[model samples]
Target: MEIAAAIQRRGLLFVLSSPSGAGKSTIAQMLLSTDDGIAMSVSATTRPMRPGETDGVDYHFVTDAGFDRMVAGGEFLEWAHVFGHRYGTLKREVMKVIEGGRDVLLDIDWQGTQQLKQVDPDIVRVFILPPSTEELERRLRHRGTDSEEVIARRMDRAASEISHWAEYDYVLINNDAEKCRELVHNILKAERLKATRRVFLHDFVRGLIG
Candidate 1:
């Protein structure tokens, strides 16, 4: 067998961050649909369930009191308040996925990414940027999901989000959605092949030499 196929590798946390309408969600959906080795890390939130969302699959929706209890118990790897809603990643669940050798994909904001890094510095961070602010506004309008006021708010917020692009390990311009997805996949593949992740490679090499 080839070295890539023979070596046992540890999994990693892959984080993707982008402002609204910058193609983050589209890329995330594409990756989840195409990649079997990676799975989305379901977040727990204190927000009410949306119309089409499922309980455990979309988010682990909880009451404010329940979320507070979890925070008090140190059950979260990272937690943040966004738009008056509390969102968090459960440490036990994410560690379980990583320990089982399956990469976890996180679609979170910059704040959550920073917190996750403090917890697990090995995470790979990628930020997507729109080609231009005007293009971003156009994409948001194309969606037709939000009101005029909401779109205006999102445009204002995008500026702040884009300022943190330098903090990510990799930054991609989302001018072409498909091309960007391909680049993201390539990054994941390369990260998976890194020598550090192949924990038993040295032993494998020794056995081969013997």
Candidate 2:
């Protein structure tokens, strides 16, 4: 009988978070679309689905009770309440993707990133910042998706979120979309070459010596 090694080799978790209007989601989408080997971990949320959002694709749109059941079942790697909606990443799905040797990209907040790091210390956390507070507010208002009060709330939250930028392993200032995308791609390239991830290095060295 053949035996498999006990080692559980997996791809890295790439986490990117940012304040609203900082363009993290756009960059994440771009990265995932461009990189065939990387998949985005769609979160489960206790929020009503917006137009054009498919179930289990954009998100696992669930009710509050369903989300609670998942939490009770130990299904989430990290869960958090954002703007009154609970959002969580399913542990099983993410693990399956990673174990399949495809990197998983998580678009979450700083709190969620912290929880993920606790679960897997190999997670690479990236935080995106707006060029300036004024620019951030301008972008928020320009979107015209929210009312005056809601926009004000988002701006206030942005300030607090930006304050925690130092907590991330990498920081990208989204002043130019293309430039920020390139920087994020560069970060991913550098991370994938780390010694720990290059498990065949020892074998390669042995071959050279022999």
The model with the greatest TM-score is: 1
| lDDT (tens digit, per residue) of candidate 2 on 83-174 | 77999999877977777778899999988988988988988999999998899888888877778988888887887888888999999889
**How accurate locally, in lDDT, is each candidate?**
0.90, 0.86
Residue 76 lDDT (model 1): 90
CA lDDT of 17 in candidate 2?
Answer: 94
- Candidate with top lDDT is 1
> Model 2 reaches what TM-score against the true structure?
0.91
Q: How far is candidate 1 from the true structure (C-alpha RMSD, Å)?
A: 1.9
Per-model TM-score, in order, reads 0.92, 0.91
Tell me the tens digit of each residue's lDDT in model 1 across 37-148: 8888889999889778999888999999999999999999899886678999988778777776689999899999999999889999999999999999999999887789
What does the lDDT come to for candidate 2?
A: 0.86
Q: Name model 1 segments beyond 4 Å from true.
A: 1-7
Residue 49: error of model 1 in Å? 2.1
